[model samples]
Target chain A: METPNPNIKMWQGNVACAEGALAAGCRFFAGYPITPSSEIAEVLSLRLPKLGGNFIQMEDEIAAMGATIGASLGGVKAMTATSGPGFSLKQENIGFAAMAEIPCVVVNVQRGGPSTGLPTHAAQGDVMQARWGTHGDHPIIALAPGSVRETYDMTVKAFNLAEKYRTPVILLSDEIVGHLTEKVEVPPIESLGLTDRKKPTVPPEQYRPYEMDSSDIPPMANFGEGYRYHVTGLAHDETGFPTNNPEKIQAQLERLNRKIERYRDEIVEVEVQYTEDAEILVISFGSTARSVRRAVINAREQGIKAGLLRLKTIWPFPGKEIEAISASVRKIIVAEMNLGQLAHEVEWATRRSKPVVRINKINGEPITPNEIFNAIIRQD
Target chain B: MDYLYYLRQDKMPHIWCDGCGHGIILKSILRCVDKLGWDKNDIALVSGIGCSSRTPGYVDFNTLHTTHGRALAFATGLKIANPKLHVIVVSGDGDATAIGGNHFIHAARRNIDITMIIYNNYIYGMTGGQVSPTTPAHKKASTAPYGNPDEPFDISRLAQAAGATYVARSTVYHVGKMDNYIGNALQKTGFSVVEILTPCPTSYGRRNKEGNGVDMMRYQKENTIGIEKAKNMSAEALAGKIVTGVFVDKEQESYLNRYNEVIKKAQSGV
Candidate 1:
């Protein structure tokens, strides 16, 4: 008997993100209408409300983020999606979630921009921005998906990491992945490893909102649950009150950053293909990663000994793996949608700037395999 | 009548000046919360950094005093995590319209069920009275010492256009009217913005001699013409003016409502 292939269906990456978010128990979505990422909000806006969830078309990206935060506190998994301009608007709030140690997923289907530079075009310019745009020192998790299938998978992963680590997680997709359609098979929701925010185990009177136990992440309790505490951006002690004391500030700040950095083993993820005994490594992420892999295959067919290291998670740099691969490879060519956002990170990781080349593109199009191959050829 | 008694002692008298409109707005907010007879514990007051952003500390609730220009962003996360709690965002003029302008518009556009109260005292009161996006043109502030070269923003109109399900404007002087607006904004099912036309008595008030806190209120009372009344009037009559009232009130699918719809669809599909 011949069994029909079940995973054969077409859907845009944005739709996959919505479906994945729903599977991740996201019942709230607040976002504005922006390019590429709009479909996630569009699908979720119609989808969430039918499931006893909430959806709000916020006044702007800032308020969309605020509304999402409010709904999250109301005990629903919440998210919002936007592009470059909206992502820039969301940095402060993202920092707020980081300091407050609140868990939520923010999807940025990145478009060209320093400031709305290109609204409808794809760009990977936000890589550094995603890491440090917020005005504070705190660790962040950013996942980049290269395909529509990965969009579904990574969205679930983004929410999972957010809840598990008690931090905001960014799904750093680009316009290509956001708008492109592909076939994806989703497993039953019952089989998914869903994580919810940890609630306080102690009595309300004994609850300390920022007090950590064994885990650096403190147990969370929603408002109306009688757990009263303060959350401030000013460096604070475990009690969550603002303090300028050097020791207290250092300890608090260290804990906030270390909570994610120390757990990089669990947070950092990369997809390596044929890196073993290779002469050149193609480094890329998001939609451009697909092109890099194809370039690697094309290079290999020409007996160039090229391989691919696709970064599924862009933050925490994946420095160790890149370093290890760099030690074995003859050259590392970085391909991205921007001029050279990831190239700098790649150079730092390898510490050999000459062999590390950047295939830069800012014209609002995906970097092609031919361009990446040409970069490698130029170096050779 | 010492309503200040309700404020959280740990946060203290705060950074507002003697005649700052933020104080009046804060008092009115507290009064609205008090009049509602809601449990303080049930309130999760969230704010972004700025003068008015300090409000979460003055009240006894599960407060999240977040970063600048991002209060509404954090509020969105909080509300979605637990939709049952009353999530209130208190923000300043610059914090709401300048750095946080994106969030302000998006929160309204999303119509997420949350209440946003902007202490629009015109100037950025806490930061030595700089000209904010909401600061009226030709007004003087630290940044606009020669005179505010930029035109001020109409926050209420911006929010109304941005898709807030409930939108209104009030001032520190109209404490009772503000309370009603606040209550309605909070009670509404989607995003609501109550632009409290608070007087920056120290900044906006002092430079313009808009009087002290008392004069600030009187100015609001005298200057504000109702939106309904202005609708029949000419633009010339309403020029150099702000019309305040419930400018928008309507119902559409809220974020949560739409979310539940998807869940139902998924359930039925399953």
Candidate 2:
């Protein structure tokens, strides 16, 4: 990655993500205004049009998701940003994008939730929602950024993964990191390894929107690309037309999952530090991970053998990594703002081999480093 | 039968029920596009979930069968993404004006260049003739077993009020006018709405004593008034009459044209 702009400049996390989108060749954004996440839309609104791309403030969150998918199908990299309430509204179309295999990014700035719990406040309560928000058995790729720099990096990766897998990728940012300002070295556009969706190798007459003999990811043909094809929410055959045949529909369902699942090693990313000969492994992600990192460092200086595992990829959960690390570790601590969303996943991943401790806080405040540090010292 | 070139023969026969008037509207849409000499690839046909939304399944164009009541929103993005693609959304009465009403009015407000073809059968036919936003007060729907008490919406008037550049209405019986209005709406450079009155014999007609599809067409022919003729009729005399024809027609810069202006101002170092 050509060294991320080569200089440090002060930028808000949302601003950095917006700049990253522009640098990553994202040409379209359709969004609705909501708390915490509105800055992403506001910044993109000003810059996308300048690049001869588009940015539309849609009627609602669902409409924003619809427009994002539509723009992507029209042959452009597209995204939409929203907070909790808006994320809830976009679930239907998010599932539609999953079923129809449209490449787009949805940014959900985590806030206090359930309903309109806390809009402006910081809380990482949307982890479970981000993974299973949309209905049915489907596949999604989500990235969580723990800092301003990672926000830029992950936003670019979100678009790349979405295009690469022909699936909707989520950049699950929380309120604290979303509003946080820090120095980031942004890379130039030419330096980034941007990826686009694969196009058909065959002629338009023989083009199938969802067909691959060996590769799970199918080549996508845009609406106006002289390949007249159908895209539907219903279970569809390889030709992109709705089908009821049990064999074809079963194959279609399996393909949607396998496309991303088979390449889990490449899609999953996590930051592991000091896990060698460690007794207590601390696991966290996004804004909460920042505090956990500090606590882990403080734990190390205090003569306690502690390690930090900060997640960059939330979905296709890093089970293998967690399971492997559990062999040497005496116990694991899963810290998050929510009650037990990712902690549940951690427990399932470790298979109860190591006792797990949860640092949970759902109040409209961040999980402080001292709080996590206390949990680190008190644990026997 | 030359219009058969536009049909995806392999995907047929369509899912529409017997005596359903949706096929008539579908043919008119194909006829209009064919008459315009449009390349099949240039046309993007989008639809929400309904019997009418099923029209896209039979077409050989760039078709999209979207989630219920989201055709216009999706089409808006497609149009904005590439201002050159002809994006046409076919939504049902319930799909467009009920669940999808907000998107409908908003799309018109932007005046984006897209043709919205509404199949107004006055009932939610796909869901077994439930009461829809356009169901007449006295019509019998499944939900309105004893007759609907709520007033119906005038779709053409709604579009005109919401700032759609082209607005027209025609019945399935008025085949020529339906084709003409669809063609006109397709050619317009802003958000255009053409609501065509069709029949739902299986669900609505059986409940409303409106007889079969032929009987419904007969009623439309007898009780409908052209926009020109309705001008002379008093409000009292126009009661119970389906007013048909062009309601709004004018030109303005579409959403894309105005957005291009935004790009100009953004790029300029002023």
Angstrom error of the Cα, residue A102, model 1: value is: 2.0
- Candidate 1 falls in which docking quality class? acceptable
lDDT, candidate 2, B43-133, per-residue tens: 9999999989999989999999999999988998888887778999999999999999999999999998999999999998878889999
Q: Residue-wise lDDT of candidate 1 within B193-231, one digit each (tens)?
A: 999887667777788767788877776778788788999
What ranges in model 2 sit over 4 Å off? A1-7
TM, every model: 0.81, 0.98
Two-chain DockQ for model 1 = 0.48
State the DockQ, from 0 to 1, for candidate 2. Answer: 0.88
- Tell me the whole-model lDDT of each prediction, alpha carbons only: 0.82, 0.90
> For model 1, how does the per-residue alpha-carbon lDDT over A18-110 read when each residue is reduced to its tens digit?
999998999888899998788998888777756767676776787677667656655678898988889888887788778877788999999
Q: Which candidate is the best by lDDT?
A: 2
